[model samples]
Target chain A: MTDLLPPIQTTARDDAVLKALAGFVRQEALGPGEKLPTERILAERLKVSRNTVREALTRWEGLGLVERRQGSGTYLKAAVSPDMLHMPLTLAGGNDFAGLMATLEIRRALEAEAAALCAIRAGKAELAEIERKLDLMEEAFQTRDGMSSEEDWEFHQAVFRASGNPLFEQIIAAMYEMFHRFWEHPLGVRDFGHASFPYHRTIFNCIAAHDPEGARAEALKLIATVEDDLKRGAANLKLSDRR
Target chain B: MTDLLPPIQTTARDDAVLKALAGFVRQEALGPGEKLPTERILAERLKVSRNTVREALTRWEGLGLVERRQGSGTYLKAAVSPDMLHMPLTLAGGNDFAGLMATLEIRRALEAEAAALCAIRAGKAELAEIERKLDLMEEAFQTRDGMSSEEDWEFHQAVFRASGNPLFEQIIAAMYEMFHRFWEHPLGVRDFGHASFPYHRTIFNCIAAHDPEGARAEALKLIATVEDDLKRGAANLKLSDRR
Candidate 1:
């Protein structure tokens, strides 16, 4: 029975303080615009230093959970519901497989839209940069031994830039970082047998032709290929576990 | 001509240090596995303290631009392309219209998928919770209010939770916070004549029937309504400007 138990995960003192403060607010049934105890009082009640309380309060304020009046005191500005407290998408450090899959799905949606937008909005300079990247990719395929993840990343990034939406670029960049850090293989790595070049060419052609729907379709197909690779990888892990 | 120019946005010393380091790396054309200069050397070259250099390096590491090896120096682990440096999605503070629109489009994509997933995966308790939230929404519509943003928020949050992917919930929560902070009107606010209640009811019916496509369609319709409202609001602003 003891062996079957899950390992205990210790919470940091600061996190504990934050939880205690959040719990206190819940227990008191604090509503929006309601005043919270002063830092000194919260510190005394929670048995933590005033600095710890202040730090937690600052974090809460950033999360829009609380508001601090300069001359007055901190007040509850938003009702921190149970669902809000259970937010699991902290892109802090490290990555889990499920989180990676979730991120990939998000990428599928955003990148498809980005490709469509790029087809509509890309200027001559932006289109030339994308063409340059594709040419570099072709060169790498011909000269180098394998596909270069760096070149592949640049190609996609160029498309994002051409989308003219900074938000898409930023989200894609963050997702790329997370995927790169977590996966054992670098992003955009195609196996020797995987004919990914044709898909890239198709996507490029769509953009070059200024076909938004076609670009979107090609992007989705590309992501679906990546998804299939991930699923196969996961299946292999399960097989190894059984063996 | 100089007076006609926009005011310069002052860069903080730390941000300036960070930018300078990034610029140095770019100018040097640093590639993967290339070791950076010692902290002492970097600080000396950048005309900043070692602590500032360390701080900037730490930020770069978090952004996945570099890697620090134990017993060895920090090395450039990724190609720092110009586009990589121009990532615009800062979920920091404040709200810009373009950012909000980007977030809304992302929401449309993710939430539609989430609703579909909820229809397929939601357990009994989760389904019950969704029903309860819908009931609360109806009550809000019936009495005490025209349309409470809080109730609307909770209703959508419940659907996200029922989707069984914490990633969806977290992303939605972050977007909600951003939208809430920036938009003059709270998220999901509609005019009394807008008749959003029927759409919510339709979504709930689809989820109850486990119709993934129906749920998705209804979710898309809801987002489309919001998008139309946003477009109208923008048009009104332009007309007012003309007036």
Candidate 2:
């Protein structure tokens, strides 16, 4: 049982400090412009050196977890995702909505690569995994009469894993995790096909058949379809404003 | 004199601990296969409690700076890139190559956003700054009759700033700092229009006109052109194989 929990076993004093700080901020539901506890008090409470506290603070800074004031203590800034994709966005210090769109563009590129590589790299085991995710997604689509957000994510994650590149695998994972809110808080019902399954199936087919061009085409078609929705949605807002 | 030193000003005990460990690691010139000092000896030499040392080690783990094994002490891992672009390809991770191409593809998406935003958001001050860079680039092109890698970077740096989106601005700054290596390192001698300045000017011209469509087109053309060069140069083994 102890060996099974290697991930959280030690958790390290500094990591504990960070996790504590994050949890406090999260539970309070702070946003940008919120204040955090003073380092001296936190240091005393955490029973670690101020130096150790400072390192944890730096981790928060690197993650865009807080806005530091030179003479004042750090304040909570953006709410961090419970996922890794948001880590790089924060690590890169991008917060604006336009920046989020830029992140999506990056995803487009990775998804294309994922499709192409999945075509070549995915073996029978990986193909079976993709097929399993596809079936799960289809079931979610059928039962929910809409794509469950979690199911949508599971399908993408499967593709990334199939790419045979751990870096791409993890980077894509981090990105999806970071953008969980945008996905979960749907502006409208997601189009599973007309609304999800063919794009998924087409991508899966290309991978299973080991056809790179077909995979790339299918991936682009998926992104293009989504971008179309975003465009129409933006236009509809303009029309509603005019009315 | 103190200011000339690295940013290690907080506490001597902690700084001494970190610096000593850094020295020990450097002595081994640690790489992927490298092993590091044991916690017992490291604590003894640093004159800190094992708990304090463990906290410091945890900080390194968070940054992916070191790895820990169940039976073994922590091993030295590579540092993350400060200049994100020029980051050596191997830093993409020893085990992943296809992932790297996908990552570059992602970067291109972010770059396109920066260019498009620069078209809309740039002010007169920004345009003037871009023009100033253009002047220097012209000087390099006309007088030197060869590449001006420094000027080449300055031009793009100006464009990222012109975007008025600090998120894109800083990202491009960091990424290009890494990409600048290709300018001086390999002389593919692609030619004037094909090289940096001409394409940059075309991009500059579109942005100056506030033509978002034109700007995006120009930005993409320049990127596609370079990507072609990257693909060709890597294939020909002229760009270090990017392997």
Candidate 3:
């Protein structure tokens, strides 16, 4: 109980129910789009309330793995999963580093394309928003704001939105959500601390100029700095302590 | 609901709950590892029964987006957030074509890495199993087994597993999962009446020989074959449809 979660008192039943279903997925060799049994049956077998089982099912449904029709049963959605939910499953099964690094590469592909698309599709309003977000970062630098990091994330998020591909925005945003911890480090803290807003300005300029190459170069520059900072941290850390 | 999924019913409540949750993710500004309210509270907020909420929550928990503690409460997992549950969310909000292509390119990069890793790390047992699976496909050519298509997937899945990178495996697996639907065209289908197991054997050889370039090239060959088949299908009507 305490070992599995935060030692909460109320939701153990739900957790147990989900555990049962996941166990079923494992043991029964169910693939996506495969439907599970009725709550009455699952509850009777798992020794939980139908309410508990239903709650567990709802959570999974929310995650987009389970698709339900009003009169139809729940079926696994093989294609509808988000990356935010997948990384941890990989981590749990063993392969966190591979997942993270691969994700960074995925980011490079996505953001590079996102910047290009933003340059092409961003309207005056979206571009203005991007510029405004960049300005916010500048203000953060000037005032030494604690939330500068967030400002940075927001600015890029602004770009993803401007790219006009909801899927791009969502996927990149989801990756950021899952990997925020990896991206946030002692070096990142320092980089964000004294980091000039000029790099962001470069991105803004390239985007505003509608220069795809320039935008990509600027994006790469930003990633380069972050990578360099991360590398430096790795160099400075003790062998056993580094992630 | 019947129109959406006519094949099942028990899963509908759970599916609606997930849809509601996906709507929540699409609508809310929740961050990873952020806890929602207790089951009773969340159920009331979502207008679903506590059981429904619990079901969705359980799914999320299994997906690794939320961690459930018996006595404390369920906490959002920072690493495996809700965003990663589906296809690239980043692609959703953007302009068409360009952004979509960019997302696919990012996928290509992931696939390349996964293929390379699979070449390097696949075990004798795993390698042998992949060969066995491929052999099954060869036999399927003779008997016209229903398992041929599925065996194809297992072969790729084995490659991912052998990569020893959970993230790579899962992401690559998901990408493959997404691409699988385009298979049933008249020109393709591994129907044996059209192609043979040798196509997969090329990939197997490269991987077993630990030649990353070879594995990649072989994979490209397979993909190209499928692509050509799809192209051909477009030029001529699907045989099944014609019938």
> Considering just chain B, what TM-score does every model have?
0.57, 0.57, 0.54
lDDT of 3 by residue, A75-134 (tens): 876433122223223333112343455566556656766787788888899999998998
Give lDDT tens digits, candidate 3, residues B24-113: 543554566666567776666656667666666676665556687767888766444222433222122112223324434445444555
Candidate 2 positional error at A75, Å: 32
Q: Find the candidate with the highest DockQ and give its number.
A: 3
Chain A TM-score relative to the true structure, per candidate: 0.58, 0.60, 0.60
Q: Write the per-residue lDDT of candidate 2 for residues B33-119, one digit (tens) a residue.
A: 477777777788777887667666654555456688869778766532221111111122221223334445545555666677788
Using lDDT as the measure, which candidate wins?
A: 1
Write candidate 1's Cα lDDT for A176-236 as tens digits.
Answer: 7666654435333346215455677789899999999899899989888778777666655
TM-score of 2: 0.50
Per TM-score, the best of the predicted structures is 1
Compose the digit string of candidate 1's lDDT tens values, residues B55-136.
5665565444578665688998666533232211334212444556767777887788789888998888988999899889
TM-score of each model, paired residue for residue: 0.58, 0.50, 0.49
Candidate 2 local lDDT, residue B7: 62
**DockQ pick, better of 2 and 3:** 3
- Give the least accurate 10-residue stretch of model 1 chain B, judged by summed lDDT: B1-10
